[model samples]
Target: MPYALTCTLHLRRQVQLLSILTVFSVIKAGHVTREGEVRWQLFNECSQGMLQTYLGRVNTRGFSDRHCLTEFHVEADFYGAIRLQHAQSRKYLCFNKRQRITLRFNGDSERCYFYERINHSGYSELESAWQPRLFLGFNGRGRFQSPDTYHVKRRCFYWLKFVRYVPEEELHHCEIRKPVDQHVRLEHTNMAHNALRNSLLNQIRATHDGPYKHQDQENRNGTYSL
Candidate 1:
């Protein structure tokens, strides 16, 4: 073989190997997340009872509880961007192409970042590969996010929602696992304890508070009230 032809073949092989390595790297890096194909649950800490209850959009407590409803269904795009669909109303939570977040029953769904923060620094530090700009935060009652909101304060907020990753099909079983507030359960247990205590006291009083016992005591003491 000619020396020049041999050199050309070597260069071609190098380029082909580089191309293959690039494709492999892209796949390993997870450019498109397959995990997003599963369903996600947004459980809010601001809810009344359990933290497992989802941050829903319908019939939720007003600004006092961040207006998060009972449940929502999360759907992800090809790029792993997510949209929260209300379980009952079927409406989607979107940015409204503005600062305020609202439920709009439109085809244009807001691309939300489903991720966690490195620290409790603020909403700005939420880690998502696709959406570093947008965030999900809560201020006890109202949930807020960035870029579309009017208030400068709304840009940064404490987390009010937590994502519960699960398959779309197993959603029904997931709902059953929603936890009850330990404090509330404890309170109920205390109330029952008190009730049982009161009942026992009443029985004791009825058994001992008899007229004959007083007479018996009087005879023993050799004294009479009559």
Candidate 2:
């Protein structure tokens, strides 16, 4: 009987040990699952933040295929510059608002000139002509405040450019002329017109259906009367 009793005690102890180990394993698994959930939440929050920063308040209707003269205003935290080009005329104009400077480019051996005051006689002429295809606008480094902060004196400038090309037609009839320096205040005009153009293009891509689908639909609907 004493031997049986000893055996029973041993069995009870083994069962107790097993129960404790099982509980520990369950706790560890719960901890791992909780950590994974926390990590996923963090990643989701970060992605949303980035999306808000870049894509928030984007203009939806400003994208189109028709080319025309356009103006824009630019405001950045530190420094800003504007570049404008007429698609048809090939005229290139640039302005540096922070530095109070302007650059004009004509497709000729006549090198580009830089000016301090827009219309002042003390304009500094650059030895090299302005290259619209190469360096059309100003390049500077600066930081931006979060969307929550309001910038009262955020440096603002106006930019103007013309687009004259149709997608299906050759660009031979385009006549781009460089803009002469004027004291006009075109606000938000400091953005490179080319950049805004590309943004417009991206907006179209984001919103419109692919060309193939449109064409396919047209074909199916017998709208291609060609």
Among the numbered candidates, top TM-score falls to 1
Q: What local lDDT does model 2 show for residue 99?
A: 25
lDDT of 1 by residue, 1-226 (tens): 6778677756655653353233222343656432322222333333322122234433223332322344455554565344556543456655444544566566363333344343332221223333455654443443343443424554343333333333335434423345799999999999999999998776655233633345567778898746
Candidate 2 ranges with C-alpha deviation above 4 Å? 1-66, 71-84, 96-98, 101-103, 106-168, 176-226
Against the reference, the lDDT scores of all candidates come to 0.44, 0.28
Residues 1-226 of candidate 2 have per-residue lDDT tens digits of: 3777667656655653353233222344456221110000000111121101111221112222323222111111122122223343334333233322233344222222322111122111111123322221111111222212213311211112111213223333333455855534343355566679988777655233644335556788878633
Error of 1 at 94 (Å): 0.4
Q: Candidate 1, clashing residue pairs?
A: 56-69, 66-141, 98-148, 99-148, 99-149
Query: Model 1 off-target regions past 4 Å?
Result: 1-68, 110-132, 143-156, 160-226
Q: Report the poorest 10 consecutive residues by lDDT, candidate 1.
A: 118-127
